[model samples]
Target: MFSSKTLAEMDRNIAKYPPEQKQSAVMACLIAAQEEHGWVSPAIIAEVAGILDMPTIAVEEVATFYNMYETKPIGQFKLVICTNLPCQLSHGEEAADYLKKKLGINFNETTSCGTFTLKEGECMGVCGDSPVLLVNNHRMCSFMSHDKIDALLDELKSQAKKGVSA
Candidate 1:
């Protein structure tokens, strides 16, 4: 189910641990699969389990337990807004509402254009950076005011038009 390059990457990850501890590489292997496929599907989970010599349920638990791993396909850009109490106190809810209204999609839904997917995330370990969001689980945007949010949407839309990846 994975490409040669992806399997090679998984193999490299597996090599990081001792022979008897191949299961320790399960997370890394899943990440490689997700990177290649854009989401962790059932097939991917089984494949990773087979490769790491672990139970499928074990791999599934890891995938579902983490917010970073997407079990279903998502848009090109995944916007995860931290809606925990600290973030809510810092306008996180307002920001999330703004995004939902602007994109015409609620949390867990993707835009009609398939350009963005909105999700409410847990604390990202930066309570002080409340009202923060992540782009594709990588880029972090802090202190998201309305203006900043608008700017970000505009920028992402422009990038989408240009066939750019977020």
Candidate 2:
């Protein structure tokens, strides 16, 4: 169910391990599948398991264990706010509350417009940059203040209107 490019990528990842250890590429394959499909559905999980020659449960374990992998469909912009101790010590709670009020959605919830998904996250390895967030699980936004969050939301809304992803 993956594109040829993704299959090729999986092949390359699989080649990294010895012949009998194809399962070593399970995470890579799952990531490729997610990149293609936007989320890891049961079908994608099964396809990954088939490609890795591993049990479906094994793939499921990896998918479920990792917070980075989206198990369900998410909005175009997934805003992950760090809520760990360091972040809490900062204005993380205020930022999250601001987001919730601004977007009218709680953590782990997607906005009604399907433009954003808010998630509570653990430490993103940047404790000093408290009140930090990750966009689409890739772009790191640090030291978010209220005004900065508003600017970001406006920018993302503009991007969404233009049918572009950030």
Candidate 3:
């Protein structure tokens, strides 16, 4: 269910590299597929392999290795809570607990309203701002407070309900 624009973008990405190097475009193609469907299906991965003249296993490797690739349905917004050492030291698990308590959904689960999905991620490279959480892949730079998380969760719900961002 990929759109023409996305296919064209993938083709352009392929053109940017030599024909023999289509493997280099694997990441872009997978991302394009992900953007269209929110998750990468096995069928699409096989199609990508055929498009790139590579093996399906090669495509799967790329998809599984990358943190950005999602294999399951995520909500309209994905709240990835970083729980690595730096984040934990800075109250990362606390934020995750807050989300679970507030949204009534644990890690790797979507909220009952389908407005948000909570994912447990590793260090998001914001050690300086250690307890960071990502919303729909957008880096939210501050953390350290449960109220901020409550506001974020509330805003996401409001946005989903209205079909507009809050």
Cα lDDT listed for each candidate? 0.92, 0.93, 0.83
lDDT string for model 1 (48-73, tens) is 99998899999999999988899999
Best by lDDT: 2
Task: Give the alpha carbon lDDT tens digit for every residue of 1-166 in model 3.
Answer: 5699989989999998987887899999998888877788899899889889999999999999988988777788888888889888888888878888888888889977677888888877878786788887655747658878877777777888888532
The ten-residue window of minimal lDDT in model 1 covers 29-38
Clashes of each: 0, 0, 0
Model 2: lDDT of residue 147: 92
Scored by lDDT, model 2 comes in at 0.93
**Candidate 3, position 84, lDDT:** 89
Candidate structures ordered by lDDT, highest first: 2, 1, 3
Give one digit per residue, the lDDT tens place, for model 2 in 48-132.
9998889999999999999989999999999999999899999999999999999999999999999999999988999999899
TM-score, candidate number 1: 0.93
Model 3 regions lying over 4 Å from their true place: 164-166
Superposed by TM-score, candidate 2 places the C-alpha of residue 49 at a distance from the truth, in angstroms, of: 0.3
Better of 2 and 3 by TM-score: 2
Order of candidates by TM-score, top first? 2, 1, 3
